[model samples]
Target: MTYAGVNRLLHWLMAALILGLLTLGYYMTYVADYGLYHLHKSVAVVVALLLLPRLVLRWFKPWQSTVKGKGAKAVHGFHWLLLVLLVIMVVSGAAYSGFGGYGIALFDWPLLAQNIDAQQQVVAHSAALSDWGLAVHIYCAWALCFTLAIHALAALKHHFIDRDGTLIRMLVGEKGARL
Candidate 1:
């Protein structure tokens, strides 16, 4: 079976958003641009908002798998794990930024107040809390990237190797028979 249109749309949209966010996150950290932190945090909040609805929709309107037996089971399990990891990442990111004492902004609107001084110094975070949040956020992001890679590889395998309709089902819904 294929996912519903809403399901397919959410899946693809979230895939893009997550990928973009991951790239931004990496660039912000490794590229040494501390200024990108605000943009990153804002986009992250958008991701969290989108994910909340997607999770609820998935729960209420579960999709039937075209793949039977063990493959279906594994796919279902992986989806759940991915969702959990996403939630963890969102929470950790929020804590890392929020507790850092800099106000979070969406575009130009401020969600949290920027409590910096004339010296542009942010409010102090406890060593333990900030460290834990940063570590969890970073680890979860890497885990998500790895999980997404596996997910894409599986879809490719089903489409090319197994000659299954799984990928097509996701792309265009359950209109035609399994290819």
Candidate 2:
């Protein structure tokens, strides 16, 4: 059996989105201009919206498994952990944006309000809250990168070593297909 078409579509779509978000997050943190932060926050919000429904769909619609016993359980557990980490990343990112008093824009629309101070008026800064949010966001993002590496390796192992349909099923949703 293969995954349903819609599930496969969502899976691939989210995979691309998450990868972009991770790359953007890293660049913004280390090598980018200040404006990249705004773009990063907007992308994170998009990921958050897509991920919520995807999680629910994954829980309800089971995929065909190529491995059995402990192997399958381990895969499931890792998937769950990844999802949890991503959710935390999204929440912490939002908190970081809010506590830093910066607004988030969705493409062309305004979602959160920018709180940059006027010359005469000083905005109260909550350094502690911002720091806490930044810590969580950064740590979770790093953890996600590590886990994603394992996930990709696992798929390669299934495709090249196990010679199972696990990777093929995800990629093309074709039953019993091999790499």
Candidate 3:
């Protein structure tokens, strides 16, 4: 069965946004400090917002896989784990930004930590939250990269090797596709 257009749209959009975030995130952290934190945080909030609706849609219309047998369990498990990791990333990133004395921003708009010592230097609570949140965020970032690679390779296998409609279902879902 094919996913509806909206579902597929959300899937691809999230995929692009996430991939972009991962690249931008890595560059900002390791490559150079070009002052892209605001952009990263802004886009992250957008991704977080999109995640909610995508999850709700998935709940109502779950995607079915063509793969069966023993590997199916692993595939499903990985997908679920990816979702959980996304939740963790969002929470940890927010904690690091919001509670670390830096207000969470969406293109200069305040989301959180707008007034709570945002002007002052890092406080004790901010430091603690920053420590824990940064640790989790960094770890999860690598985990996310590995999982995403696997997910992409799986999709490629389905499309190229399996030649199943799995990739098609996601790529160009039919109108009013219900299942």
Which candidate gets the maximum TM-score versus the true structure? 1
Q: List residue ranges in candidate 2 displaced over 4 A.
A: 1-3, 120-125, 175-179
Model 3: pairs clashing at backbone N, Cα or C within 3 Å: none
Q: Residue by residue across 19-119, what tens digits does model 2's lDDT show?
A: 99889878877886677776777777788888987788778975546778887888788888988998999888877777767656787677877676667
**Which TM-score value belongs to model 1?**
0.89
lDDT of 1 by residue, 1-179 (tens): 23477788888988988999999989988988988887888888888888998899878876676678997888788988999999999888767767767667886888877668789888745546767788999999999999999989988998899877888878877675343
Ranking by TM-score: 1, 2, 3
Clashing residue pairs found in predicted model 1 = 1-66
TM-score of each: 0.89, 0.88, 0.87
List runs of model 3 lying over 4 Å from the truth: 1-3, 114-124, 174-179
lDDT by candidate, in order shown: 0.82, 0.79, 0.81
Candidate 1 stretches greater than 4 Å from native: 1-3, 176-179
Candidate 1, which ten residues in sequence have the lowest lDDT sum? 123-132
Could you give me the TM-score of model 3 versus the true structure? 0.87
